[model samples]
Target chain A: MSKRSIIPGFRLSIGISVFYLSILVLIPLSIIFIKSFELSLAQFWDTIINPRVLASYRISFVTAFCAAIINTVFGLIVAWVLVRYQFPGKKIIDALVDIPFALPTAVAGIALTALYAKNGWIGSLLEPLGIKVAYSPLGIIVALTFIGIPFVVRTVQPVIEDLEKEMEEAAVMLGAYRLRTFLRVVLPTLYPALLTGFTLAFARGIGEYGSVVFISGNMPLVTEISPLLIMTKLEQYDYAGATAIAAVMLIVSFLLLLLINLLQWSMNRRMTANS
Target chain B: MAGVVRYHATTKKQTREKHIDESLVVRWTLISIAVLFITIMIILPLTVVMTEALKKGASVYFAAIAHEDAMSALRLTLITAFIAVPLNTVFGVLVAWAISKFKFRRKQLLLTLIDLPFAVSPVIAGLVFVLMFGAQSYLGPWLSEHDIKIIFAVPGIIIATLFITVPFVAREIIPLMQQQGITEEEAAVSLGAKGFQVFWRVTLPNIKWGLLYGIILCNARAMGEFGAVSVVSGHIRGRTNTLPLHVEILYNEYQFSAAFAIASLLMVLAIITLIVKAIVEWREEVQNIHL
Candidate 1:
């Protein structure tokens, strides 16, 4: 009912949105979908199931998932520290978390490579210990984790800030130990935000290119990611194949996010009902 | 009698309970992991870039700037940001207007689509533009016939960035609009203000902070975009490559000092944006306190 009050009678704005989104998002996406149609079902399967492509998928998904999981755990901590603790330069550290959000992914990749490559400073230190980070799956995980952490931290930070400290105190008074209180009370409250962060970080990691490519060393089936493989396909002029594989990536990412959201929604509902 | 007993038991619970360990192990562990990640990934890399640039000395730093490609990269980055930022700001406002003001079929779908670039792989975003404009689609033939080249060109690079950055301005403003009730707009309309006037005079001022935040975000994203632009930008020195792409090129070609010099420049811009956002947010908080 209130929606009718806001429309100031302008078709111009609405029309422009339709046109812009059509040309920019829809047309390009349709072409990608249509290109996949040009390939036979068997060819689509073949393209997606190729050893190199399969390897890239494994590298991308498994690494992204792992990075996201790592981010979920650690990002929550960072968020908690920034929100609950007051310390010197805490605001600066809080802002620093968003550096990955602003820094160009490629630049990030280059920087990470410069620092983590065998001859680079950190890599040199780790090399003596037989821990190779750059040009390996470990590098991908690090980059993804770097970019992914901010999502979780930013997501969970506000929730943590707004958390009712009195409730925790009450739980303590009710004889719940600190660990039990966290596991039973705090974790349940933070679950939705955590899931939201996980999905965002996972989605971001899955498609990340610039940062990962530099340190990844990009060996086929080793450090190669799906995005890189898609780029390789485009360079090779295999449009249909690239689109097919990309579609698969897209579907997998969407399904994972949707499933996560469903679980989050159900949890949120249950929490509301219980509280 | 039982209810009274249970209430007394609840009240006495703390008396019998053991004092809990409050070492904050889980919280501290999470914090430690984040701190470690930052130290290894961002802080160390940033230090190396700083060290590399500083080792070159101030004279070398300026000389690196005086280098031809580096200069062009700076100029090209400025040109692209100038072109992309205002366009995105205007489009983003219109998008925010449409999404926030209007209700239609699949409204949430449109919002989701607007956010697609943020979710989708930037590489995929660039690849989609190629598929659309890469001499293969219906428009590809028409665009070529009309001498409109997009892929592997400057325009293609800008478009790829545009796609990746479409959400910032709109996203920043949407929540603000929801938070700020539409009473002012209604008041303006009752005074016989036209649609454009209402937007320009009344609506813009109310949401200006949000708009500024969005513009800053758009500038950062557009300026630093690499994953999306790398696909479409042919990386032609001074021609198609944006600054980030330029940094990547220089680094790949073993121009480490020059790369860090440029990296410092962009880092300066990012830091400037950070400062501006902090000031704006602080100002907004102060205003909220007063109101």
Candidate 2:
């Protein structure tokens, strides 16, 4: 037999794929690193470590962490309800979970701003209680939570569905209570999925801009997020400063996400081996 | 006699536990909390979009969308999607075919690189292009000398969008195609069918639904992309503004009715995307059942 491969067009297809990926995704991304490297070490350090920039980083990370935690808890509940129980409008609720995915970030920002502004619907109720939802750091958390919810729900839903009912039944038969069984038996299987979802949500939250910007009121040191800061730097025509901040966000996020992905992979392997 | 009685009582307890789910009170409480959260987080914003749009009369709402800026924004949004989606579709199919069909070294690395866009911020997506093509870059001066404008123009908006949406279609198609191994294609090749014919007749039919699904999602994102487009678009009224940016400009200008009017249009598109996605999911479920 000749040593030729059975599939034809392999060369052409692979060539096109690599070229497209490089031109469209890889090369453009590398420009950020290249441009940022042009800055002197001191200048780069100053640009990324200034007081306002530090504040934005703090806000972005803290709010994203809080939002991810909140999403992890509530998203589990939402997924559990969808998978374990049947109710009226169940289909509608299931469809509604993806709205944050489908809705434009700008629209989400405006709609949320309208509903949570001091004179707005929910904001009006909270105003009497000395609470502010819009144009504050709290508002950033709200928007992040809103967008991040679907990530957790979608990631964990399949795991919940795949869980065997016999395990829960066995626990119940052995005198374990409902909550105890869930905590010991069900939650372990879901732990990796939940963590993966949380990481995904946090990563998205850090990069988020349009939705957070309007709700945040774009205050310099208080509600500004890292992505918004990048935008501000660009607007001020401070390209080097913008590139420096963007590079830092990119490197940190990429590392964190990579770590999470590796962790999830190992966990998934162990879980499957156990099963 | 006492031991037997105890055994009977334990069996009775087990039966009760098995017969019931969570207690009704607990079940209802979980259900209520989930529903309430969904309504507040999702339904409220959607309702607000519609209510605010029509808060004024329908005539005013119509006038808002019919305004010159809104009209041009809509046109630009469509043009961007129209150009970007097909190009990405072709790339997605090619990449999916190559990665799934061939056994190459560092395949996982390639997959990871494809996923890089998803991990990166959309704002960064816009910034990277500016670095490449903005006036300060090395190529920027040469391009300017040649009278080529990429940043703050239609091309800039398209490039930013193309970058942001790079992975959607490929990510979707890759998994599906990998699950479908190359046995049929091999058989076709042995039967004397050409490569193009085999791909068109055999593989294309199998991946049609997935390809369409990817296209739908990519189109929605391309049209609705705000952060990346916002950076590169330069806020040129009636020119570089996509529908989402147009909404921003109007909202910033304190024209709430016009903003919501345009936002309502986008909301409708989002709803339609969800419906299409739901249908695709249902069809997949049905197909799974058959298999």
Off by over 4 Å in 2: A1-5, A271-275, B1-20
TM-score (all chains, Cα) for each model: 0.90, 0.94
Q: Please list, in the order the candidates appear, how each scores on TM-score for chain B only.
A: 0.84, 0.91
CAPRI accuracy category, model 2: medium
lDDT tens digits by residue: candidate 2, B1-291: 443454344335343454226887888999999999999899999999999999998998999999998999999999999999999999898889988888887777788788888889999999998998999887898999999999999999999999888898998889899988989899999999997898899898878788888998899899999999999989999888899999999999999988999999999988998898888878776666555
Each model's iRMS: 2.6, 2.1
lDDT of each: 0.80, 0.89
Checking candidate 2 for backbone clashes, the offending pairs are: none
Q: Per-prediction DockQ, in order?
A: 0.53, 0.66
| Candidate 2 lDDT by residue in tens digits, A1-275 | 24556988888988998998899888988988988888899999999789999999999999999999989999999999998777899999999998888889999999999999988889999999999999999999999999898999999998887777788888888888888988899899898889889999999999988899889988988988999999989999999999999999999888867977786678768767977
Candidate 1 segments whose C-alpha is farther than 4 A from its true place: A6-10, A256-275, B1-37, B102-105
Per-model TM-score (chain A alone): 0.91, 0.95
Docking band of candidate 1: medium
RMSD of each: 5.7, 5.6
